[model samples]
Target: MDKNIIVSWMEAGMIQVPNLLMQKYKQIGLDEKELTLLLQILSFIETGNEFPTPEQLAERMTISSGECSGVLRKLVQMQFLSIEEGVSEDGIRFEKYSMSPLWIRLADELKFEKKQSDLKLTLLEEHDLYSLFEQEFGRPLSPMECENLAMWLDEDGQDPVIIKAALREAVLAGKLSFRYIDRILFNWKKNGVKTLEQARMQGIQFRQKTKQPTQPTTGTSSKTIPFYNWLEP
Candidate 1:
């Protein structure tokens, strides 16, 4: 072992482990004895001691050598630590433990946490979408309306932003019905408008294309425009 390397590590700050590791200790399948063993191993590594015997480990704790050996064996079988036989500086064959498997387990735990967090965020956004609809409509949502909204989120996998944009378009068109909003969402989906920006840009393009110079009408009586004509297939 290099004395310079040990001196450099001492010059560095305190050894810090992630708080999540302690928080999720039980979730990672660590019993009290196993956790204690792991901490002891970590301490041994920190002090530049590679291999501590079961007797040496047991003496530091309240457990016996046999109990310590049993726990260590269990940890090895669970792949939390791997034992490898190596020659020490004293020319004696000793067992060396590697903590790579524990790191791998922590990595898996972090991935699971991220996936769960993402799922929670998506559900929150879906709930927000429902609330937005109720606020805009100025009434409690009907059961059928709630069902349709669930289908749009769960079955159709429509984004909340796209649905909100479609609702705004329906409001602009003076046709504030669920069917009209659904049709708008359908059309936007068909046109590959997956985001609010894409829908807004598409709306701008459509308005530009339809905008024309107003012509003077000859008849004195105004024509009654059909409201349900927009719903025609």
Candidate 2:
């Protein structure tokens, strides 16, 4: 390793914590502890001769030994590894772990996900999604309402498909009001408005037919002046 490069990286205040880890935690879907665990594992693999044992992983994560074993087993179950049960130097062991080629692929996938979230999150904040609500409604929303709006836009939030169906229903029903979207959402969910076609079909239809004046009402007598009367005068 270049000493100067190493020193420079160390000097980066916190760059040593791995950009990937930072990015992972920054995503709304991932929490700090999960990110920390993944970072520790990745760092271990990068530095150690092979995949670290559960005990070693536990120590690094500052978790209990049993929890470490369980977590490692879960990783194996998650297909991040393909390990077989075996005994370690401690006589009996759960399993010995090895890296699957999938880790790199997963890192790439996770990084892509992280970047996409960053874009969406920044847009939501910079554009002020609360403003979207207020602008659309032509009124100021309550703080709680704004928080609800944020939840909808969150990366791990509710399905947009469901949320949109609710809006559609509210618009379709004469009872339709942005204020009533929450209540109408239940109806939309029950009605299963999966697409625009379904929603349009569900909307109210109006028909207009022009009616001619009812034949001047038969009870009324019609008065007319003869053309010859004017000549006599």
List ranges where model 2 is wrong by over 4 Å: 1-129, 147-158, 161-165, 168-179, 194-201, 204-233
Per residue, candidate 1 scores C-alpha lDDT tens digits across 46-148 of: 6666777789889889999899999999999998888878886899897778877887888898899899999999889888888988898989899999999
Clashing pairs in 2: none
Residue by residue across 1-233, what tens digits does model 2's lDDT show?
A: 99999999876434146454455444424445545555566666556424576677777777887887776566556665566566668887664445543345457768887899988976766355445446656788877876665565474243454555545544444343545665544443457656556544544311011121224457885443321110121
Query: Which of the numbered candidates is closest to the native, going by highest lDDT?
Result: 1
Cα distance off (Å), candidate 1, residue 117 = 2.9
State the TM-score for model 1: 0.67
Ten contiguous residues with the weakest lDDT in model 1:
221-230
Clash number for candidate 1: 0
TM-score of each: 0.67, 0.33
The Cα error of candidate 2 at residue 75, in Å, is 18
- Candidate 1 global lDDT: 0.81
